[model samples]
Target: MNTSIRRALGTTALTTAALLAASGVASAHVSVNAPSAAQGGYTVLEFRVPTESETASTTAVTVELPGLASARTEPIPGWTATTEKDGGDLVTSVTWTANPGAGVPPGEFQRFVVSAGPLPAQDEVEFPATQTYSDGSVVDWNEATPASGEEPEHPSPTLELAAGSDDTVASAVAAPSSSDSDTTARWLGGIGLVLGALGAALGIGATVRSRRS
Candidate 1:
């Protein structure tokens, strides 16, 4: 009922809100943003990477072509590109690296293009990624294949290659669409806001009554 009690409750509420906001930002790091493999063949795949830090820029992107034996990339100007073979045969698996010119500014994104060879006749292929920031921080986008319904603690953008014809594995990674999932989420959030407002009003009223008594 006292000024001190009101102040403490207000501080606790604000602290909770801040914690939620911070958690949201941390969960929203690097994500895949373009054409997914939709009926795969010799097609160009574009990956978009946006740096998270306002003070740091993105300096490099490394794409690990796991299992796909023959994949190549189109040359990017002002950028250094290289490829390395996986263990076993020299042509079995390859990983490519691209360094951006200068650095990708905060809130800005860069695209990486690579040519995929003929996809496997069946099964899915995941193109995992690792992103490097200008401040010497690296984020690996490779999470467990077939995401477990939970956004991973650390998640990477992945392209799912479905099997059909010889060139059936679609080369397109469709961007996440909010239209299907977030509508109910928004309604629930509105309900939560109303509940929160009601709770605050009750607390204020209780404080007033106690002070009068």
Candidate 2:
């Protein structure tokens, strides 16, 4: 292969790799899944936790439920769910402990569900979580989202509370949709394909030019 064609191909390959890496990072995070819900109603919330440690599995997850009137956890097999309450008899936090060998392993994730609310009047709710690994490391996802719209390194999972009737809120939580990460991945993949095609065309043109020289 000629030098011009080889350089074009190399550049294209690098660009493609970068796009794939970005897509992976975009989706790797602890998140909450709830499509939409009313401001002052009840809804089921699912906390999605992904195991990040290669050496250990995710053994436990504790989520802080600030500003919530009440919450009841859904039973998960192989995991024990516990709740912490304050003097007001309101739940302050919920923790799910994995049974022996039941923790989420590397490259895997688990979702813990809870029926919570009398949703507050706020536009959104942030659930700060502490993830514990079998290796004894802890990850605190407690950062509040900033006004600049940039996500933090360990951002607290947030659920957007939309304006709807109480009945709508009940149905909203029943049907969870694709996350922001999925949408981002699709967009990135499309751009990568276009760039890759352009790179291949350039490489072919370069080869033709070299041959005519």
- For model 1, how does the per-residue alpha-carbon lDDT over 1-213 read when each residue is reduced to its tens digit? 699999999999999999999886654555543344544454566776777778888788877664444557667655666676644322232333445457678878777776665544435555677778778998887886354576665566665654445324443222222342367689999999999999999999999999999
RMSD of each: 29.6, 28.8
Looking at model 1, which ten-residue stretch has the lowest summed lDDT?
171-180
Question: How well does candidate 1 score on lDDT at residue 67?
Answer: 41
Q: Best by lDDT, which number?
A: 2
Clashes (N, CA, C under 3 Å) per candidate: 16, 0
Q: Give per-residue CA lDDT, model 2, range 1-213, as digits (tens).
A: 699999999999999999998877756788998885557777899899999888899999999986455688998889999998775565789999999978999998998999987676668888999999999999999998789998789998988988867565554444222343467789999999999999999999999999999
Model 2 lowest lDDT segment of ten: 172-181
By TM-score, who's the top model here? 2
Q: Local error of candidate 2 at 199, Å? A: 94
